[model samples]
Target: MPAGDSWLFEMKYDGYRAQAAIAGDQVRLYSRGGHDWTRQFGFVAPALATITKGTALIDGEICAIDQHGRSNFSLLKTSLDGRSPIVFFAFDLLEQNGEDVARLPQAERKARLEALLTDLPADSPVIYSQHVAGNGQQVFDAMKAGGFEGVIAKAPAARYYGGDRSTAWLKIKAVQRQEFVVIGWRPPEYGVDNVRGLFLATYEDGQLVFRGAVGTGFTDKMRREVHEVLQLILADGPLDVKGMPRAEARACRWVEPRLLAEVEYTEVTPDGLIRHPSFKGLREDKPARDVHLEVQDA
Candidate 1:
């Protein structure tokens, strides 16, 4: 695939990517990883019922936006009392009026989505994802200038390829630092009893990518915290990847990838790995997978 192509660009929202399917009065919300989040986000289902009649599959991010239009995931997680305003930034229409429209070109689907929301209330949970024609680079630049993570470029005429990581959808994220769980440890090539470095991995797009390991920036307290977590998951056995054991020694304790730390990095490698990443701190609000290497716009 080439670098830059004719594509529909949207802001890479900092929230869970969900597909909301409304059938008659029944609405089912599925996360990007295929998890049923219908119960967790009940507020959205009721709003979806009001706008959709027969059936509609809407692609969007379930985000909690503040007064300044900035997403607040931490606030969203804590204030689950059903009072916080959660908005669904509807970006695409997959199925409408009992017809499967995902096979149609993306431009057609987006047009349908836009027409559906044209007369709706602006403050409604559903908001049409904005796009500018013939200015992909400018859109990307504006997103970066606004301190956003990045942008995602989707082929305007592409079809919905479910459960498949295709280059048709390209994600460009802001270069930010984040820490990950030290799931396992790898030995040094030649050294004493000390291990070479810790293996860092995070879940993204339903898969785990080894974000390289961290040998430096380890404090005594950090090491102790990592060791304690590693000890617990070790008895269960080494963490499996693709049905095979991760490339780590038995002596190395395998920890559950639950811990969230902050790290800083400059760029992502050609293989979609983080480069020159350094530890920052623990982030209690974010999940391990959400901390994976940032996606870049192709």
Candidate 2:
């Protein structure tokens, strides 16, 4: 995490990034990829509508909270099938009273967002994402100890760069996690499910490169569900990827690089492969082209 008084640290949620636009009684929700998901997240829209009587734009995450009140991505995937309730953790206010406030400093935006959510009921679906001006190390340690995802360190005086990745915001994870494009797959050796492992890839130097494979962290039901989706997007041949082994290439089934997979790994090898990687879930919030190995910037 960044060490300085000018930095603000907030809890990094393990959930889908979403934006809510409120215009009077009309509240529309959009995904990170700019897809309309108001219906998919019907449970959270009503709470957003109650935020302002005029108009406002809020940016936050839609997450499924576990029994311990921590955001859980696995639970979120299950909840997508209409199994459980979800919450919207509002973190920033982009537009207030129909006026664009994105150019405002990060600290100012967060303060306005908190104020907008202050009148929400105790059991409201939308909650403000609180942050600390400093003490990043202390917060990260506490989050790690509590089995939370991680912390996001942001420059308090920096403006919001919407739809653009910037150094003003940094993600510091307790565990290593990344989003990889699903390039290929391997059939289960001896199982009812069609998929056993996913061959992953990430963008490097403006080209797609073979990262590695992830076979673990899938439940029997999830395996079956994911296999169904993979079947429809089969490709005639693999996309030309740098460092693909010929032997493994002949053994795998290639697919269109439209699916994004969330993966957790212990570390990266010297040759640019992920170690001890496991599948977490499929991510639809982000475009596959944006999947790249994250690095800390100075």
By TM-score, the best candidate is: 2
What's the residue-level lDDT of 199 in candidate 2?
A: 92
When summed lDDT is taken over every stretch of 10 residues in candidate 1, the lowest stretch is 240-249
lDDT of 2 by residue, 1-298 (tens): 6887779999989989999999977999998889998988877878788777899988999999888989988788778776666899998889988678999999999888888889999999898998988888999899999999888888999889865368888888899987899998888777566688899998776788998899999888888888999988999886888887887687788999989999999988888899999889998898787778876332
* lDDT of candidate 2 at residue 136, scale 0 to 100: 88
Query: What overall lDDT, based on C-alpha atoms, would model 1 receive against the true structure?
Result: 0.67
TM per prediction: 0.69, 0.95
Record all residue pairs in model 2 with backbone atoms less than 3 Å apart, i.e. clashing: none
Residue-level lDDT of model 1, residues 1-298, one tens digit each, is: 1235567787877555688888878999887656788888877787777776678889888877766676655446544676567878888898898788899988888899888778777667777888654467778788878877677678887887654246667666665554565566655455533444566677766665566666666565655555555455543666643222334444354567666555667776776566776654444444466555544444
Which stretches of candidate 2 lie above 4 Å from their native place? Answer: 80-83, 190-193, 296-298
**Residue 84 lDDT in model 1?**
61
